[model samples]
Target: MIWKELKKQWRFMDGVVIASLVVLSFVPLVVFSMNHKENSAKEGNIAIISIDGEEVDRFVLNEETKHKEKTYYPGKDKYNIVEMEGTKIRVKEDNSPDQIAVRTSWISKPGQTSICLPHKLVIEIVSGKSSDEKEEDDDMIITY
Candidate 1:
């Protein structure tokens, strides 16, 4: 007798319960999609083009030299530059390991003082050409 009474109550509430669950599930999916879109849009390009017309795809700043060199001081943050034939991309620091595709025009021209990219801006430049063709050829000569 008690079982039948409880079953009747549950049957009447079934529609409401299912509707609530469906709404709950939908909320998270919506939130997740929005979050993913925001994250994807934030990723930026990382590259460096020297004033001397030299393009370096992969570069690592000597930590010691970086500390001493105030000219290329990257402030407190860490960054990397990905150098291509015609463009240089700047990648900001983040914990996540992901590549950002950035398409930006060059702002600093050759023969300009303080032209070297900050040491913190280390980036991996992708090249399709042969190794010899992808040499670090820059017109700006580094004088010590």
Candidate 2:
């Protein structure tokens, strides 16, 4: 009896609705899939250090780079020591009281940043980008 009642109400529109729903569920799969470009041999990762919103130093990050340390003076008697080695960069030491940037160590990927707000300094990592392309993506929001 239940089967007979269901057959009486079901129509062509019901099949259409079910089919459309199935198709709509797959739309996200096609829409959200992204193609990632492999890093080019000619281009390598770079780290940029800035003081008071101006770039002060830039370094190519890779295993070939020598282990080095550079100190930046952002204000009177205030300094930040940045270290780079083997494709990784970090704030080795700083005069800031909280020592937050110093504690966050070894950033080695695109979009990673180490900021010393008190000293008005920033270090940002960029991957496979030219100068112009880097400027455009400065405001990009990277989500997990």
Candidate 3:
């Protein structure tokens, strides 16, 4: 019959088509799982800024409204303005060429960071806990 003839002609590609569809279905699940893990691990609201490998400033992101610092590095006079509204911190202004740091969006989590390579500056969000408290918490988690 015509059906049998058609099946015989397409048999070789049937498995390949089905396998590709199955793999494509799992891609969205994997992407959403990774995004969930990153969001769940968010832990802090303190912003720490470092320039040239030295700690330059620290601000409680929720307490401060705004802060601006001008930096002189060798031949450049660069600057950054940090603004915090409620619990979020973001780079409101930056003098870097590409302005990547200023465009990085707002952050309020422990591991979040914004960096400007041309100016050698890095801003990181850190947990509010003291080192001793953090060490004890880590030990407890391991024991559990």
TM-scores, all models, native as reference: 0.25, 0.63, 0.57
lDDT tens digits by residue: candidate 2, 1-144? 999999999999999999999999998776544321235233667899999999999999866889999988899999999999878899999999999899988898778999999998899988856889769858977899
- The true-structure Cα RMSD of candidate 1 reads 18.5
lDDT for each residue of candidate 3 in 1-144, tens digit (9 for 90 to 100): 999998878876798999999999999999987864454344335678888888878876544445544433423576777666755777788778999888997887778998878887788988766678667857543343
| Candidate 1 deviant stretches above 4 angstroms | 1-10, 44-144
Which ten residues in a row are the worst by lDDT in model 1? 62-71
Q: Which ten-residue region of model 3 has the weakest summed lDDT?
A: 66-75
lDDT of 3 at 34: 87
Q: For candidate 2, what is the TM-score?
A: 0.63
Candidate 3, residue 60: Cα displacement in angstroms equals 1.4
Which one wins on lDDT?
2
Instruction: Please list the Cα RMSD from the true structure of every candidate, rounded to 1 decimal place.
Output: 18.5, 8.5, 7.4
Which segments of candidate 3 are over 4 A away from where they belong?
Answer: 1-44, 63-75, 140-144
Backbone clash total, candidate 3:
0
Query: Tens digits of per-residue lDDT for model 1 on 63-117?
Result: 1212111122234543333222323323322322343322322222212122223
lDDT of each: 0.38, 0.85, 0.72
Give per-residue lDDT, candidate 3, residue 72: 35
